[model samples]
Target: MAEPRPRVWVSQPLIDAVIEPLRAQVELITTDEVTAWTAEQLAARLADVDGAIITLNERVGAAQVAGATRLQVIANVGVGYNNLDVEALSAAGIVASNTPDVLTETTADLGFALLMAAARRITESERWLREGQWGQWSFQTMLGADIHGSTLGILGMGRIGQGIARRGAHGFGMRVLYHNRSRLPEAAEGEVGAQYADFDTLLAQSDHLVLVLPYTASSHHIIDAAALAKMKPTATLVNIARGGIVDELALADALATGRLAAAGLDVYEGEPAVRPELLALHNIVLTPHIGSASLATRKAMVQLAADNLLAALNVDGAAARMPSAINAEAAFAARTASGDKSKKR
Candidate 1:
């Protein structure tokens, strides 16, 4: 008898062209509709599968993997992997991967678009006009901030951050300032035309502030009421990073009371369910987390994820072969220590 083919579960409906090839070599189980899977549902699906291709919506941790003895890999469709407990996945000998570089430029484009929209009050002006309020044009009808020759502050200067910096410095002729855990090398900084600044300095000097930092225990609520107090009342804020970094209530208060000029947010703490306070405000621009929503970029993300899943599942020396495996080394170490050499691919 032939050995059973590896079982792989796809947690959401992905592009058919990107996913169809997997059926040739694996027993592919897929979800047609989007699902907010419960923890129990996650564990149950993982229990019998050898691998899974999941999106940001699925949160997996120790409990989800406790019974997933056969599970070997998880390929996350997005760059951010906060949805997965990487430590737990590594300890359980499961390699995890994500699509990163492919979406960098696209996400950066959206971030800058949001920054321009909020700073210029583009969306707000359109909404007012649509409400038939633009009876006549006046010089000060919708006076908004200027983009060029302004100071642009960016937090968390990674690839996307660098992209934003380049756009601000070279394209918009803006003064670019960035704050990160460590300063970028002189050459990299020069290339992006950005200067390093302390946290407070970045906050105080910026005409437009963009948050592109990762979400972690230390980063959570980093931009709370106190931080907001430090920013210029005329400054515009844009968050293309995770939502948990800002306090929604405090942010709403700032916009409502004119403590800050305006804010553009793509991600929210409880996403798809924005705070009512934010919804009621007109100064803030809200988007449904479409940072990398372009067709080409989304397809690339799915393709990269599929490539990672297949490589980690069927390729010889799977760990080293995965394109963007996050915890392959640690996962392989755990497997080796457990005397699971027979299962090592």
Candidate 2:
């Protein structure tokens, strides 16, 4: 008998172009609402699907995936898959893929934008102008830090971090310094004119600092009151990374006191629900996590995820390339093994 068409659950609606390719090989149950799906809803939606395409909004942990008996893969559109518990997914013999390279440059662009906005007081100045405060111009009115010929510090040195370093070093004539879990090789550092700095040095020396690290237990609150205290009083801080990396309460305190110059945050610890302390601060710029929000980049991310989903599900003649699976080996093992069909890997 012919194999039955795979049933897939799409967490959110995608543009027609991104979704069309999968229409022929998969039966899709897609949600039209942009709102995030609750745990119960996810359990119900994913119960019988062979695969799923999810976004950051969906939090899939052990409990969430407990009932996903038929689920073979979960493709995420964004580079970060913290939303989906990889350990749980791998244990379930389910392949989980994320779109990474496609959104690297786009996210880097936002990181730089946030850096400049925080350094130059762009958002604050705009609010001032809109409030009709532009009537008088003084020598020091709205004066802010300069990006050119300044030190640029990055907390994480991944692809996105490297892109930001290149822009700062080559385009702005800034000294780029990065601190990662492990230092990059000399050649890689030379490519971006970046130097490896210890965490404390990166905080103290940078005239403008940006956080681009992943969200992990170790990384959570890596930037706290003490870290903020190490920074120069006039330095600006920007976080394009996850919110939990920085203690939001400590950050707001720093910005409120004259200890730090200003801050720009694209992601918040609570997410979608920012701390009221941050909102009350005037020297900060807040964005609702639009790092990869560009029209073209978003489209590309969706397309890449769709392609990976197809490849992972092995739709007939779908190229069958392994998706950007975090646990590709385990997934392949699952495919090859005929015995021990337990949910956990």
Best model number under lDDT: 1
lDDT of 2 by residue, 132-186 (tens): 9887879999989999999999999999999999999999999999999999999
lDDT of 1 by residue, 172-215 (tens): 99999999999999999999999999999999999999999999
Model 2 poorest 10 in a row by lDDT: 336-345
Query: TM-score of model 2 relative to the true fold?
Result: 0.95
Top TM-score prediction, candidate number: 1
| lDDT per model vs. reference | 0.93, 0.87
